[model samples]
Target chain A: MDLQLIDQFAKNIIFEAGRRIRTAFTYDLVVETKSNANDLVTNIDRETELFLIEKIKSFDSTHKIIGEEGMGEKVDSLEGVVWIIDPIDGTMNFVKQHRHFMISIGIFVDGIGKLGYIFDVMREDLFYAIEGVGAWYNDSPLRKLQPVKIEEAVIGINASWVAPNRHIHHEKVIELVRKVRGTRSYGSAAMEIAFVVSGKLDAYVSMRLSPWDIGGGTIIAKEVGAIATNLRGEGFDFFHQDTFIIANPSIHQELLEKYIVQYD
Target chain B: MDLQLIDQFAKNIIFEAGRRIRTAFTYDLVVETKSNANDLVTNIDRETELFLIEKIKSFDSTHKIIGEEGMGEKVDSLEGVVWIIDPIDGTMNFVKQHRHFMISIGIFVDGIGKLGYIFDVMREDLFYAIEGVGAWYNDSPLRKLQPVKIEEAVIGINASWVAPNRHIHHEKVIELVRKVRGTRSYGSAAMEIAFVVSGKLDAYVSMRLSPWDIGGGTIIAKEVGAIATNLRGEGFDFFHQDTFIIANPSIHQELLEKYIVQYD
Candidate 1:
C-alpha cells in the first residue's frame, strides 16, 4: 500500500466529515440521553458518523469500523483495516460550552494505528498525523517532543479521577496532582491526547476510555515520539474498553511504575 | 464621565494588546519564572501588560492600577477609577497550551466593578460588559442567560478541588462534582468566568483566587444576569483573595447554601 495515498485519503474523508458537522451546526439538534440524562448525544454525532462510515466504505469496501455513536460496522477483532471514529469528541463541551470540541478519526490496520486526525470544527484547526511521518498542526509539521519530568509537566486529567471514585484510589491521584506543575481537563479525551502529541501537555491519564476515543491519538502520539499505554505500562487493546495513560517518552515508564499501580 | 468613550478606549487598547501578542506567537519567546521556577511568566505577558498600561496611562494617567505582574501602579483603594489587569489570565496555559487563555481587564470605581473586558487573544474573540449596557461577544450583544439546574448544568472547576486538599472540604466538593451534569477545568479563571456569562458553563468554582484573577469575569457575569459571590453567598470584595462561585441565577443560591457554607 502506498502510505502517502492512504494518508491523503484519510485526510480528505476526515475533512469532508468535518464539513458535514460544520453545516449541521446551524440546525436545531435533537439531543438524546445515552448513559444518563447528563450524558448527551446530539443528532450531529449520528449524522457525522454515518457520513464518515459511508465515505470510508466507498473508499475501501473491506475496512471495518468502530464508532462512538454505534453507527458503523462491528468487529470482534482488529483483524483488518479499521476506522475508529468519534464524530464529536467532547460532546458535553460541544453541547454546553459550544466550543473546544473536535471530530477524531483513526485509521488502523491489524490493530496498529496508521493515521490519526483531529479537527477542531469551530476554530477550523486540523491536527493530523501519519505513523512514521510527523504530526501537523494546521500544515506546520509538529516538532519532535522533548522529554520532561513529571514535576515540571502539565498534565490533563479529569477531576473525576481525583474525586472520590470507584476506578482508582483518590489519594494516590492527589499525590500525583500535587507533584505536577499544574493540571487541566478540556472535557475531551481526544483533544487531550492530541495535546500530548503536540507537546502542549506532557501527559494525559484517565481511568475509563473506549477504543474509539484513543485509537487515532495513539497513532499520532507514537509519531511524535510519545507513548500510549495502559496504567500497567502494557500495550492497549484497540478493540476494548480500558484505562489509558499517554505521555511523553521521558516520563511514560516512570508514571506507570511509580504513579499508577493496580489497586483492588 | 463618558462611559461610552471609556468603553471604546478600553476596547481599542485591548485589541491592540491582543495584536501585539499575536505578532510574538511565531517568535521564540524568552520565558522566565515569576514566583517559583514552576510558575512561568512569558515575555508576551509582560510586553502585553506594558502595552496596555502605557496606553491606558496615555489615555488617563490618574487611574490607579493593580496588575498581576506588578508592573502597574499599586492600588490601595477603589477610590477614583482603578484598573485590575491580568494580561494573560492563564499564564500557564499560554506558556504550555498556547490556547484556552485570555487577556482580562476589569475597571472598578469605588470598589464596584463598573466595566469588564476579556479578549481571547488566540481566537480573536472579545467579551465585554459595561455597568448596565449588557454584555457582548465580538460585535453581537449577548442574550440574557437562561436558567440552568445543577443536574442539567455543566460546571468549570479546578481539578485540585476534587482531590484531597486543605483549603476546602474535598468530600463536599466531590459531592458537588458528582451531582453536576458534568465538570471541566480549563486552567484559566478569567476565561472560565467568561464562559459563565456566555451561558456555556453554568457555574465556576475556585478555592484560591486573587482579585485580578477574576475581576474582569465578574463584571461580565453580572451583566448577563449571573451572580458573582463568595462561597458563602455574600458580597464579594474585589480587592482581596477569596473563594468565588459564579453561576446562573437559579443554581447560585442553592450551590452556596448546600455545598459551600463557610464556617469558622
Candidate 2:
C-alpha cells in the first residue's frame, strides 16, 4: 500500500471531520448521557464520526471501521484494512470546555497501523504519521523520540489510577508517580498518546482504553520508535477494550515488567 | 476607576504578551530549572512576564505590581491599586507541551479584584473580565454560571490530590473524586481557575497556590459571581501562599465545608 496516499487521505478526512465538529461546537451542543451518566456524547461526536465513516467509505468501500460512538461498521478483528476512529475523543471537554479535544483517525492493515492522524480542532494542529516516515506536527516532521529516565521523565496518566481503583494497584502507581519528574493528565487519551509520540511526554499508561482510544496515537508512536503495548508488555488487541502503556522503546519493557500490575 | 479602561488595558497587554509567548513556542525552547529541578521555567515565562510588567507600568504608573518570576515590584498589601501577574501561569505545560498555558493578570484596588484576564496564547483565546461588566471569551460576554450538583459536575483538581497529600485530606479528596461526574487536571492553575470562571469546570482545588497563581482567575471568577477562597472557605491572603478552592456559587460552600481539609 502507498503510505503517503494513506497519510494524505487520513489527514484530509480527519481535518474535514474536525471542521464539522468545529461548526457543531459553535451552538449549544445537544449532549446526552452515554454508557453511564458521567460519560457524555454530544450530537457532534456522532455526527463527525458518521461524516468521516461516509467519507472514508466513499474512498474505499472495502475498508472496515471501529468507532468510539458505535456509529461505524462493527469489525470482529483487526484483519484486512481497518480504520479506527474517535471522532471527538474528549466528549466531556467538547461539551463543556469546547476545547482540548480532537478528531483521531488511524488506518491499519492486518493488525498493523499504517497511518495515524490526530487533529486538535480548536487549536488547528494536525499530528499525523505514515509508518517509517516519522511523525509530523502541522507540516513539520517530528524528531525521533529520545530516551529519558523515569525519574527525569514527564509522564501522563489519568487520576483514576492514582486513586483507589480496582483496575490496578494504586500504591505501585503512586510510587511511579512520585518517581517521575512530573505528571500531567489532559483527559484525552489520543492527545496524551500523541504527546508521547511527539516526545512531549516520556510515557503514558492508562487502564480501560478502547481500541479507538489509542489507535491513531499508537501508530504515530510506533513510527517515532515508541512502544504501545498492554500493561503485561504483550501485544494489544486492537479489536477489543484493553489496558495500555505507551512509552519510549527504551523504557517500555522495563515499565511493564517491573511496575504494571497484571492480576490486581 | 474606569473599569472599562482597566479591562481594555489589561486585555491588550495580555494579548501582546501572549503573542510573544506564542511566537517563542514555534521553536524548541530552552527549558530551565527553577525553584527545584522538577519545577520548570523557560525563557518564554520570564520574557512574557517582563513584557507585561513593562506595559502595565506604562499603562498605570500608580499601580503596585506583584508578579510571578519576580519581574514586578514587591507588593505587600492589596492597598491602593495593585496588579498581580503570572505571565505564563502554566510554566511546566509551556516548557514541556508548548500549550495549555496562559497569561494571567488581575487588577486589584483596596484589596478587591477589579479586572482580570487569562489568555491561552497558543489558541489565541482571551478570557477577560471587568468588576461588574461580566466575563468574556474573546468578544462574547460569558453567561452567569449555572448551578451544578457535585455528582453531576466535572471537577478540575491536581491529580496529586488522589494520592497521599498533606494540605488536603487525601481520603476526603479521593471520596469527592469518585462522587463527581468526572475529574480533570490540566496542570495549569490559572487555566484551571479560568475554567471554573467560565463554567467549563464546576470547581477547582489546589493544595498550594501562590497569589499570582489564582489572582487573575479569582477576579474573573468573581465577575461571573463564582466564589473564590482558600480550601477552608475563609479569607485568602492574596499576597501570601495558601491552598485554594474556587467553584460556582452553588457548590463552593459545600465543597469547602465538607471535602476540604484545612491545615491550621
On residues A46-149, what C-alpha lDDT tens digit does candidate 1 reach at each position? 98888888888898899888899998766788778888889899898888777788888888788777888888888888888888768898879988799798
Candidate 2 global TM-score:
0.95
lDDT of 2 by residue, B173-200 (tens): 7788788878887878888887888888
Where does model 1 exceed 4 Å of error? none
Error of 1 at B221 (Å): 1.1
Model 2: pairs clashing at backbone N, Cα or C within 3 Å: none
Q: Residue by residue across A1-264, what tens digits does model 2's lDDT show?
A: 676776677777777777777776557778789789868888888888888889889988989999888987668988889999888888778877888898888888998878888888888898888887678998789888887887788788777778888877788777777777777777788888888888888888888888888888888887788899888777777767788999988878777766557665
Provide the TM-score, chain A, model 1.
0.95
TM-score of chain A of each: 0.95, 0.95
| Best prediction by DockQ | 1
